[model samples]
Target: MASNLPAPEGVEIQEQPTAGAWGEWNPTEDSVRPVRGKHRVAKQRGGLARSSTVLGVGVIAAVGASGIATAQDRPQVTISLPSLPDLMTGGDSGHGGAGDNGRQTDGGSDAEAGTAVRTGVIPRQSDHRADAGEVLRNRILQQAESQQGAAEAQARAEAERTAREAAAQEAKDKVEAARKAAEAAAAEAAAKAEQEAKEAREAAEAKAEQERLAQQSGSYSLPTSAYTLTSHYGDSGSMWSSGHHTGLDFAAPTGTPAKAVAAGKITSAGWSGAYGYRIVLELEDGTEVWYCHLSSMSVTSGSVAPGETIGRVGATGNVTGPHLHLEVRKGGSTIDPLAWLESKGLNV
Candidate 1:
């Protein structure tokens, strides 16, 4: 209590800071402000134990989260051991009363960390590196397989499209060919039908002409029926009276009936020398028709109509077998009966 004197220069004075106007200091949200980013400071020596523990925990967390393979090939690094006793005692022996006051100034922490890392404390890096390489290889192979599958699918689709197009074209071609063939067949059938129709028309016209002629020449008839002409008019023959035949000879069996050529009148009857049994008829036009060679006579006088039975065919003229010698005369001169009959629309 006497006059207080100043202590030595190295000694610190314990002075209590005053809580101004507040009775007992109790901390509250408004009483303290947390240190901002820029104002924060790292403790130098006293906080060694806490800093080492925090660093060790952070390293372990990093190693667990990402395998060693995630790190690139690099130089080895030092790591610290978090055992507090060894670290605290080592720092106490090395630095004096500062360590007792929870401050250690010695640099032993870096050496201890290096020793801990060198002693092979963590998991082996070689095994992790191999696992990482295998995983990378598998990923590459998977990607390649996926690409190949996509390529194959594209190729199959292209092939299917090409096949579909080809099939469509083939079907189109087949349809076109069928249409052309049908058209050609139809045209051929039409031409054949037209030709057949034309032939039918010509035949019908010919028949009509024949019918008209038959109707126009009423009562006209052949001199006889079922007769063969052995000699023709103007035919040179040794059996004829004039060395050349003067009439159309109608050969037939004896007693075969002979008819009138047309409506006519009987001019003469009976035989005349080599002219045998003969008859003469004069037509309405004064054209004379002579029927020589007769086996018998049914009507030897008076007028007669066409196709009336007049006599029988016989070998009567200057002749051979039974036959009718037919002659046409105009102006008392002989004419060819065959030609005259054709002009009158007779087929014979």
Candidate 2:
């Protein structure tokens, strides 16, 4: 028994009979089958083109994702630093980053950049502090030098003043010594002058006393009676061998009164050889007057007055005749009676 199968829509059905079998067989076609030769090769080429297109799309999508991630990270790349405005204006704003200036850039992390800026600014501040210290040291040294100079000058001035004072005191002492020497010289000169004046006065007084004594010794007066000179003093004749008169002979008559010629005391009233009754009278100045050749004596010794009768004239001894022999003497020397008597304003 063989039977015919019904065919489906848009398909042809075919069957094959089995040998020695009684049934017809219909084989199902495979949905995936190996194409033969050139048809398989053509199908492989189409599959390769589709795979290259898918790979190109995937590479493009990966590049687009990398660009988007880079965009998002742009705002996060921060650099913190000091800004120009902050430095110039001395602002208190604490915020610092690359956003402040678009032109400025940094190669380090945020903290590292900030530390570099701070280190860079420290050198300028330290330099200013060093300069101030140097100025202060110089001022201190200059002030010390000035003070030392002033002290030295003051010491020098004091030394000069002391030297000047010593010189002035020495000069004053010298002047005082000279003044005392001059005063002593003046006193010595005055004393010498006074001594000389006293000597001159003594000499004048001695000369006056000598003149007064000479005047007293030369004065006398003579007795008055009528007489004649017979033998004079110093006359030589044959009456004596020596040819000299020993006494003055006055020729007068006997009994002729003899008078005293000066005021005196009668020192002698007696007789003697070559003179009859001789009488000697001593005057007030110690001079002797003799009346000789007297015949008689009226006044005695120690009694006589001026112009008083002392004796009576006569030739008593060694006489030729009656006459008077008169003599005058001062001290011990015989002198001419006429001349001595005339000097006292009397005439024989």
Q: Per-residue lDDT for 170-191 in model 1, tens only?
A: 9999999999999999999999
How does candidate 1 score on lDDT? 0.66
Candidate 2 residue pairs in backbone clash: none
Candidate 1: C-alpha RMSD after superposition: 18.7
Q: Which candidate is the best by TM-score?
A: 1
Could you give candidate 2's per-residue lDDT for residues 96-158 as a string of tens digits?
333333232222332343453434432134554577688888888888888888888888888
Q: Quick one: best lDDT, which candidate?
A: 1
* lDDT (Cα, 0-100) at 129 in candidate 1: 64
Give the range where candidate 1 is weakest over 10 consecutive residues by summed lDDT.
34-43
Which consecutive 10 residues in model 2 have the weakest lDDT in total?
Answer: 35-44
TM-score of each: 0.39, 0.36
